[model samples]
Target: MAAKKASGSGSKAAKTTRAIAIDAPPLDAWSDLIGHDRLIAGLSAAIQQGRLGGSLLFVGPSGVGKTSAAVLLTQTLLCERSSPEQMAPCNTCPACVQVRAGTHPDFIQVSKPDDKTLIPLELLIGPVDARLQEGFCHDVHLRPMQAKRKVAILHDADFLNEEGANCLLKTLEEPPANALIILIGSSEQRQLPTIRSRCQVLRFQAPTGEHGRQLLRKQLQWSATEDDELQVDSVSDEALDAAIELSAGDMHVAIRLVRGGGDKIREALWNQLDAPVPDPVAIARLINGHLDSISKDVPKRRAALRDVFSIAVQHYRRQLRNDAKSGEYDPATHRRLDRTLRTFREIDRSANLGTLVDCYAADLTLATTGDRGAIG
Candidate 1:
């Protein structure tokens, strides 16, 4: 059968502009990984004992290094100088170097495009004209050119549509010899039962408290090393603490707060919410401007708005705490928090961002003014 070229130029999500860009450490730089010490140790032992399964599922919060850990494991499996018993990658070897560079022949990684809501079917199997002739499923079965094993990492497994998941079932059912398939998702509950049942599940927790602080510190150090203008000493402890609290243990959010002027945005949001009248129109404009500054892409804007909602939730929760300390209850504050949360969840499902923002702002106004009306 002759293969036909895929039609149209493929689409991609717009690149988000960050105040300071922080790249994940190279795959072979295992020491750079944070907050999964026990998981890593257990995996290393499993590798040494030859008990590691061919198909594995890593379920965890976003930005917690699940994908990074998968890449490191791939490096270990393919490293030229390391035996399985050693479970370590010699970063200097050809295999390790290629894996670190993302040029290794036996390593395959696929994730949902930022613009799209799900992992497209064509990514798993081949495009319509060449089913199984190309893409990840076909590539995973090919003979390894350098390493003894082929490793395929499917990221964003949470976004796999029914068709895509079904296409992957056969490969999961009978994987090629010496091949490893790893799926990374937010949670096992987000996965289809058939898909989850086929793989060994490893759960990961979001780093919190001291672990969260350490992660942020490490990121700052990395940023300092990469950009001569950035000095770790310049960032105040107060800023770090604020970022940690706002981020709630998600490193990606923490990074944005510390490096992306998110702290200032949060402060602005708080000030607006604290206004005597709490103008919904003004609040909506402030948030819309912040979202626009993040990206023109709707998905990115929606995500940023969700973060804004999180900040508002925190603000009201603090008010509630203060109310408790003063031996008084403010129903308005409690209602405002509830409305903010509802709007946050709606960000994903609502198509019209402007309307969502407008409604959200009005709801907050109503909640704050103690108006007896439908909120959000």
Candidate 2:
């Protein structure tokens, strides 16, 4: 059985991230990558100067380009340079080709187990950790193995519980000059202070609905031919809208929602217009649709909804914490966001679903419309 985990929006929705496309072009091919332009530029500059930190923490909402950006940076760092302006791979090169195929000598990717479980102490030691810390470590010590830098990427980095985190921390604290570690966590604060302290943090945000829509179109280019009534443009709007909403400002979430039977949200809508089952305008209605629409006769629906809210709360809290770092959303929005979250916390503890949902949703809508942030 696949490990079921709660996603960032706090939804326990299942995710189906296919094996990365080998033929996909490396970093530089992604120039106008909608949101997080600043992050790209910063990473670009650091690599160009050879000024990148040994250990980096890529933290942000779930879907923004944290993992993708890390992949790109690795490509740039190893690329034989034509110019400093671009540090990622020139995909045509030999090394770049291997990376695209996921067979590069000096690169490794680490994630959780099949149980959708956290990284246990043992897995992090002998097989996964030793391979990177010792084997790859020794190789990179001499010189770049085809590529200039030896790279290790840890995804869902927050899953490294106390023992696992401790092991990685030891390596990160005094990393070899030949090594570069990228830790991609769902949220900044969610990462342990011990881990967060050692690495330079780079934040990623969810790409806009407009940007995500374009990506989906390009990938799933199913045009309406002479024989078919179905068209790519027609199907995409609903998919994109659901993606954007489900992601809750995380690109990863948006993409996942599109994949894991998330397209169901589109069909769930018309019935929801008056009844408001799937797409609830109010918080209570959303909760009702989410938890009540369950038919598999299991706890999956409720658990998934719980997970979604957890992630959403975490994101809202993050916005409030670093008010200065992110200027796009002002302080007022942060305060409003905070109030909404506090209400969520209150609801999370309650057993009575109906009252809790109704109260929280009404409160948030009221807060959003007012200047002083009062829940009417």
Candidate 3:
């Protein structure tokens, strides 16, 4: 493959950042990747020393390549010929090619079952002593077909709830020697503190606008106007004003209101002059304010956060399905959309009107639009 540059123009502030993809050499240059040198360097060193731990946690937000890094590390470890200074896999090599195609016999991807979201208790943790007397290997240590070390990659480590996390604790603490358990997660804090302390953690952050765009462009092949390759499109003045209020500088959240059913709320509010519509963000603010007041009024803040997240997710989903065009939506918006949906799904695993309306005004604001008068 050819080498490629990572992001857009890097600001001086970015030098201190831990964004992904930035350090990786693009396939174009395939050698001079700009940002990820620190992480790459560390992992390279670990693999060389053969001191890499059996259990590892790769933490950070989406799209940055915790998964990609795991894949690369797998490549490096499995490569037959290794120079003293170079631990990266030569992608053109047969081992690299097989790993890239995911046909490698030794690599096993352990994740939540397709039908179930969380890694099941029985699957991760073995049965109690009496029941498990037969000495069978745990699901993870079942051994690879041929490679020296069996690799088990767990993506979305954060999705494992308390029960799920606990189940893996025993295995994580005493991983099999033949096993390499690599976990891909968004953040250290997102997991239990006890779990956080056990394994070595690698943190990744959002790419700079430039590098982010490069990855987006190369992989997504998206076509749009951009500032230095950061393909940001300005919504109409009305949408901008609303998004600006709701999202602050988090463009990901702002874009959702534009591409998704966010326009529905806009369209609904444009009737007679006597009325007005609220933007989705505004609706969030209005409802959030009330929820805040109630939380302040009451002694605690239980369930409110979850409630807001669930309600907002429902709203975003409506927008997603309503406005989906050829399976496209702003990346940021889509992320927010997923967040809300997942939150609701979990809440529905247990856990809506006017005062209740204030409860959902922020979502309504996003959904409704255009009416200039007042909250409708």
TM-score of 3: 0.54
Select the stronger candidate by TM-score from 2 and 3.
2
lDDT of 2 by residue, 1-376 (tens): 2122111211100011112342222345547354666777787777678788889998877545566677776666666654435653577776666655655666655666545447655444434533332322223233444655677777778677776787777767777788788888877876898999999998766655676676545433422236644355666577676656655665444544454455454344223322312233544564566566653433454344544454445545554557657645555445445654554334323334555555545545444422334322
Please count the clashing residue pairs in each candidate, in the order shown. 0, 13, 37
Total clashes, candidate 3?
37
lDDT score, candidate 1: 0.74
Best by lDDT: 1
**In model 3, where do residues sit more than 4 Å from their true spots?**
1-34, 81-85, 92-94, 125-139, 142-144, 222-359, 362-376
User: Positional deviation of 287 in candidate 1, in angstroms?
Assistant: 0.9
lDDT per residue for candidate 1 within 79-170, as digits (tens), equals: 89987567668888998877766667677777776667688887777678767666777777766657899888888798887888999998
lDDT tens digits by residue: candidate 3, 50-148: 778778999865545566677777776666565424765677766666666665655555454435656555444433532221111243454444566
- Give the lDDT of residue 315 in candidate 1: 88
Better of 2 and 3 by lDDT: 2
Q: Estimate each model's TM-score.
A: 0.77, 0.60, 0.54
Best-to-worst order by lDDT is 1, 2, 3
